[model samples]
Target: MNVGIETGPVRTGGYASSPERSGLAKFVSDTSAVFVREILLLLRDPMTLIFSLLQPLVFLALFGPLLTGALGQGSTAETLQWFVPGVIVMISLFGTSMTGSNLLYELMTGSYERILATPLSRSSLLVGRALKEFAPLVVQGLLIVVLCVPFGFILHPLHLLAGLVVLGIFGIGVGALSCALALAAQNREWLFWTVQQTVLFPLLILSGMMLPLDTGPGWMRTVALFNPLTYIVDLERALLGGSFTDPDVLQGVAAAVATCAVGLVVGIRRTRRTA
Candidate 1:
């Protein structure tokens, strides 16, 4: 009766069966999952995406021609070279600024709270949402640029890609901040709307995304100095114009990075509190 050592490999639970992911790896995985979820949601709403793009295209088609005369750049191509960057920035601004509203809607439906109940990282919720904005932004920007090409906009592949990268970074910050605002105004929807509208137009005008700040009144020029978007717009124009070595490029990069840092800090902290 040799009931000899019948010890088979001991069974282990899930955690012991697999090595735990490192902190950074876990974060990356969580963020990627959230990003994919957001993108899938976005894809389901094709009409919203189409409508979101219409305003920018209308601006290019109607306002673009007017800008040629206004800037007196001597050619439609030259004018577009200058105006296109601003329009793309405009898309980034408008597109990301309202991201909070989506979060707010989710809150109303209790989906946001349900998501927070999961084991997913809170910071990833905000970051992944912000990152999701980048795809539509890039697509809308590329389409706008392509349309402009027929109207004389020069296309430098590398420069265009780089400029979009910069815009995407800036947009992440804006989107994150928007998410934080959503968290703050979770109960007061009107507060979010009020604050968003109040802040957004000023940033747009002050950034000189639609007009040059060079000839603005003394006080306006001084005010523009405090607006980070001004530097980014200047940098975008410079990069798209093949002026990569321009001095303002450094400032723009710094501004984009700073915005991203601050927004992430605020957004992540707010998200954790919600959890």
Candidate 2:
């Protein structure tokens, strides 16, 4: 009776009382740590920086001139205008694909399990890894833009911003898909090599990396419609001073959204099992 009388009202925190809150907080902190680690790792690998800068520059110098005659006068100038955006997208794809390699490496070394053993949420790990991949691409894109200024390419600020956003979104979607595929792959190294030829090359061709869709065959044009990279290229073209119809732009946005959604679902499921 005395013990029962000693008992009083017990109160708890409101929304903050939810178990998810602590998990979310831990996830945020862990995600930040992951991002920082990724950046530092990239910094240590000087080759990544060299290649990232050189690839676009080489493409601009080589293909930029070759395609000049085919695109015609004003169009040639306009096509040349696409160099920066194209390079930006290219870097985004390449850089983001590396995320898969990182994930695969983690899986191979059991680092993924270590991370999952912590309180971090799955979303945080996935997103933080994706963003870490994207950050370098952004820096490379800006560097390419800076280089373009000396070449007489006047990039509108809004256009530049829009192009970066598109590239970032596209990169995240593609990177996630690549990561998921890699995770599911029995032989990750072999799969990584094949992805370049299979996934990346098609995206480049369908996206008009070398030539405009108008210059391609009717069937190729139809195929391009289905390629998500086409939208990225179209969005880049629009950002770089070419005409882009509302419907076409909308299609591109849809493709990017769809790719990202599917990839995310697959990646999350795969990671959960592996993690």
Candidate 3:
């Protein structure tokens, strides 16, 4: 006779125990789901992306000639070679920096709260939304580049690719920071727009995205040094110019990485607490 031993019952169908996903796997899955949802929304309402191109196009057409005339040294193509990179940066900045508004709208409509009720990690929510900005930014950048090519702007495939990578990295940070700001101003939407516009223009001008800082006053030059966008603009110029060995590239990479780190940290923390 054997000692009495009981066997456990096996669960069936949906009640069966399955292997739990690892942390990394779960995060990736959740992020992808959120990203796909965002893409769907973008496809449904594409006007925002289309309208975003207008400002950059206007700048390229109207201001580009003026820039060449003012400089009085370079050909139109040479001016565009320098100018187009800044325009790409502008595309990234304008496109990504305002992404928080969508989040803010969702918050007001309670859609975001519904999403928050899901099991998705807060980090994934922020990250997925930030990743959505990359598509539109890349599209705008490419369109601008292609449009400029006929005007004498040289096109280097590798350099443009590298520049897009930098722009994508920088856009991630700006977008995350924007979402964090939206969370902060969830109740006061005007404050979000006010702060965004107030800060964005100064950064744009100070970075010499439209005009060179060489002729600017010393104080303007000093302030530009502190703006992360300045490095990005410079780095884009260097890369497009085929100055592969330029030190600004390193500086730009460092700046973009730092911005991404800071933005993600702040966005995730705020979302965790607020949502």
How well is each residue in 1-275 modelled by candidate 1, as lDDT tens digits?
78776453332321111136558886887798789888999999877678778887888788878887888789888889998998999889888988999999999999887787666778889999999989998899899898888878888889888888988899999999999999999989999999999999999899988888788899999999899999999989988888789988889999998888888899999989877
Q: Mind giving the per-residue lDDT tens digits that candidate 3 earns over 1-275?
A: 77886455333321222247548987887788888899999999998898788998899889988998887747999889889999989989988999999998999999888787776778999999998888888788888889888877888888888888988989999999999999999989999999999999999999999999999999999999999999999999999888778999999999999999999999999989996
| Count of clashing pairs, candidate 2 | 0
TM-score of 3: 0.92
Error at 176, model 3, angstroms: 0.3
Best by TM-score: 3
Question: By how many angstroms RMSD does model 3 differ from the true structure?
Answer: 5.4
Residue 28 miss distance in model 3 (angstroms): 0.6
lDDT of 2 by residue, 129-247 (tens): 76676677667888887877776677677767766776777677777777777777735578676865677777777877676778678999999878778777677767666344546
RMSD of each: 4.8, 6.2, 5.4
The candidate with the higher TM-score, 2 or 3, is 3
Model 3: lowest-lDDT 10 consecutive positions: 9-18
Off by over 4 Å in 1: 1-19
CA lDDT of every candidate = 0.87, 0.70, 0.88
Candidate 3: residue 91 Cα off by (Å): 0.5
In candidate 1, which residue pairs get closer than 3 Å at backbone N, Cα or C atoms, i.e. clash?
Answer: none
Candidate 2: lDDT over CA atoms? 0.70
